[model samples]
Target: MPDLSIQLLPGLKLKNPVIAASGTAGYGDEPNRLCDIADLGAFVCKGTTLKPRAGNPQPRIMETPYGLLNAIGLQNPGVEAVIEKYAPLWAGWTTPIFVNIAAESVDEYAKLAHRLDKVPGIAALEVNISCPNVAAGCLEFGSTPESAAAVTRAVKNATSLPVIVKLTPNTSDIVALAQAVESAGADAVSLINTLRGMAIDIKKRKPVLGNITGGLSGSAVKPVALAMVYRVAGAVKVPVIGCGGITTGEDAIEFLMAGATAVEVGTAALVNPRAPIEIVKSIENYMLEWKLTEMSQLIGAARR
Candidate 1:
């Protein structure tokens, strides 16, 4: 049998390399119901904030050709509520639970980290640097190396658990952004968050999404994600968790070969609840066919 397990970061080990992306997994409850959570590498819950956000109004999601456009606006319970309600359940699960956190300021980000630190159920923190820093005139923290590093430092100082900075593709230079967080003490990095995109209702003469603009994900973003993962992986020494449009074991293999230690499934799961588990099975099958003994032989194979 091939070994799918991976040490994603110091003290953050995954049984495999297929994590359920945030927003799609919904705190692992629904996905757990659909498939065994134990079969997944890790699970990232919806973006949590310091306070509960109502999120955007109606028509927050729309189906585009070959992709999904979502402006869910990070609707999630506050960190305190999450700990009180879900932490106990996560403590009992075998799979690692990563809380994807988003905030508008450095102080708020640190506070969320501090609040989640030492929690029994949470294994790590995936910082969503795509949130705009209110203090910086609403400039997204992931848009620049300096601001991204600042948030990373604050969060790192607040929590002892591994911090994986989630990079945004909307930035001017993604490689620089990844390097900045790595230098700021990030344990690992994940990319690329959905590309910024939107659609129009020609009949209604208006935008399809309620927010007018939303994040683009699914098959259409795979190539961009693959390129970003390959570039960021070469630029940093930490593990890279590839995400975007991974829908199959073959797609996951493409990312693993590009140097991502693991991959996160988002839109695919939305389309099919069992996508993550199937992806795991697919990887196992691929390993069997390739006669590979372990993940190291397959990971970064393309870079060579």
Candidate 2:
């Protein structure tokens, strides 16, 4: 088979371009019992906050056609718990584990990153800027270029680990935001965090999600996600990690062609814990069938 290895970041490399999205994958240890954790390019742990959060009220998830809506509210144990609980476990695994961190303010992000700096097994840091369901200033940081850059800059200063800023799809110009983060010292950028969407229940006569609104992700958002990846890839110099509704190898190929150095599987993982491993196999088979030499050759292959 063709070499599937792709460099996700300048210094950070992966055996393949398939990674599990944060929040959906839980800790890297969750799926280790079901499949080989080493098979994935990387697994991002659930979003960790400054402190443990109960998350949004019940009915936090609702199924939609070919997609799902989630208002997870970044529920996670505090950063200390993450380092104490999962970091050691991850250190023993061969697959790189990127820690996804979320905070209400730039200062919070900085403090969290600083704490994680000394933790072992954390290969990288993914700043979660697109959390729409939080009541505090979570979404605000991602809604504007200045705030986005501010968070990126703060986190960059706090840690030497490779920083990948996760961008929210709720913004007006995602490309502009991507450029801003790149300029702010992001080693890479991941996009299409989640589309701000809502579901309504006629029988219940109210919103389906307890938060009234949630982030939409799944196969339904694939096209929008691919388009944004394509646009952002062209606009920024940093590598783009494409996410949002990716399920199959074909979907992954689409993102790779659009210029994503790697692809992240989210909701699919919830339905099947082995989804990312299957995706890695599927991509490998597809690469062989197409006689591709390296995964990087597929980047930006799609033309308008």
Candidate 3:
């Protein structure tokens, strides 16, 4: 090991900064079979709602040029089931487990937060304020500062666990939303959730995804994600978790340089379940090559 640990918050210290992004990694069970999730810093489970959702219709995903477009619609087994089934299993693991939560209304978000707070295995809460595929409350809360803040405040008030607000890239002013969540009492922030995008089947003259539009993620969105993370990380005092199109350790380094205290791996896990593990190794190698030890030594070094 290369002293990869980092303190994302005063009390929320991580073994390393490369965590598994939600949706792609299913509550640490699926990937744990292929790769020991305990090797990574932490992993956020798929988006959980107050009630179960069937998600959108079939063909909810489409392959794009450099990434994948998905509209999972926050499909989950509901918060109650999540705790009943996985909390005990997670409690034995050394790696922290943060549950990614999505809800249609502010009240639901708060209620879900309160419920998750009682779960013994959960490490923290990452509010998914940026699910653009939804037509109702999630999209509404994430698209604007007021609604975003409303959601953030509700969850913060409901839970004692550290709350990390995940910001949507679909907004005109991401910085404003970042600040809003901070003011509303978020402990940290994660930026650049997949960009809102669509793909069309030219020959069929129709959209590829059943939802018509989906979130764009993968190596292609790195520049845009990096720019947003850089802007938000510098602007907010809260630690920023950089997510979006990160497929390699080199990409992870770029995000940390851009000012992200940590980074999350999403789409890459789809291609290779071992990507996160490989990324962890790659990061350790980078540390050795640069004669660095602590992962904190790389964070925001580019900005300074």
Candidate 4:
């Protein structure tokens, strides 16, 4: 078999280059029932916060042609509850669990990092800076290089674990944003978070989602995501984890060729629980047909 293992960071090595995106696997309990968590390179838990969030109102998810729109609003139990409940369970699994955290303030981000630092079973942190910073009048921390760097610095100061800043495609300059986070101590970076989108209910004469607007994801966003990953990869020295609309091994390979060190399977897993594993298999098959010996040959093959 082709070697599928990869080192995402100095200390964070994954058996494969496929991660189960945050929220899709819901802390790994339910998904484990549908697919083996051990098969994934890593699992990012639901987007977490300092406090438990009820999330946005119902009718929050809508399916579009080859895409998914969600305004779930970071619904998650408080960090303490997650540590107490899921940490124990994660400690026993062979797969590393990365806690994906979001916060409204810089302090909250640091605190979340501090709380999870040195905790057993938790291998790393994936900071979700796409959230609104209430202190900045609802401006998303990821909207600017300054705010994004602030969050990255805060989290780095508070934790010893590797920090993977999950970048938002909503930014004006994604390459700059990636560079900012990388300088602020991000060990790796992942992108692009869902694009802003909405739908109108033609029959009801109203919006489809209660939140009115939500993040757009799935195969529809693949092209846009591929472009951003390619740009950011060239801009930063840190590993880039490509996400958005990746539904198959072919999709994963596109990101890899575009310079992604790994790929995150999000909406596809919601469509098929076995998507991640299936993608891994397909990548392996491709490597075999091409006679590739290691992941390095594929990590940025197209860049050449």
Candidates in order have lDDT scores of 0.89, 0.88, 0.89, 0.90
Native-vs-model 4 lDDT? 0.90
Q: Would you estimate the TM-scores of all the predictions? A: 0.96, 0.97, 0.97, 0.97
lDDT of 2 by residue, 1-304 (tens): 6788888875778998899898886896654576677888998988899999999998999898779899988888889899999999999888999999999889999999999996888899999998888888667899899999999999999998999999998988998899999999999999888888998899989999999999899988889999999999999988899998888888898999888999999988878877888888888888788888887678778854
lDDT of 4 by residue, 1-304 (tens): 8899999977878999999998887998763576799999999999888889888887889999869999888889999999999999999999999999988889999999999999999999999976421232113788899988999999999999999999888877999999999999999999988888899999999999888888889999999999999999888999999999999999999999999999999999999999999999999999999999899999989999
- Note each model's CA RMSD in angstroms: 1.9, 1.3, 1.2, 1.7
Name the runs in model 4 displaced over 4 angstroms: 31-33, 131-139
Itemize residue pairs with steric clashes in candidate 2.
Answer: 218-245
Residue by residue across 154-247, what tens digits does model 3's lDDT show? 9989999899999999989999999999999999999778888998889999998889999999988999999999999889999999999999
Q: Rank order by lDDT, top first?
A: 4, 3, 1, 2
Instruction: Evaluate candidate 3 by giving its C-alpha RMSD to the native, one decimal.
Output: 1.2
Shift in Å, residue 272, candidate 4: 0.7
Candidate 1: lDDT of 87? Answer: 90
Candidate 3 TM-score, true structure as reference: 0.97
Runs in model 3 deviating more than 4 A are 31-33
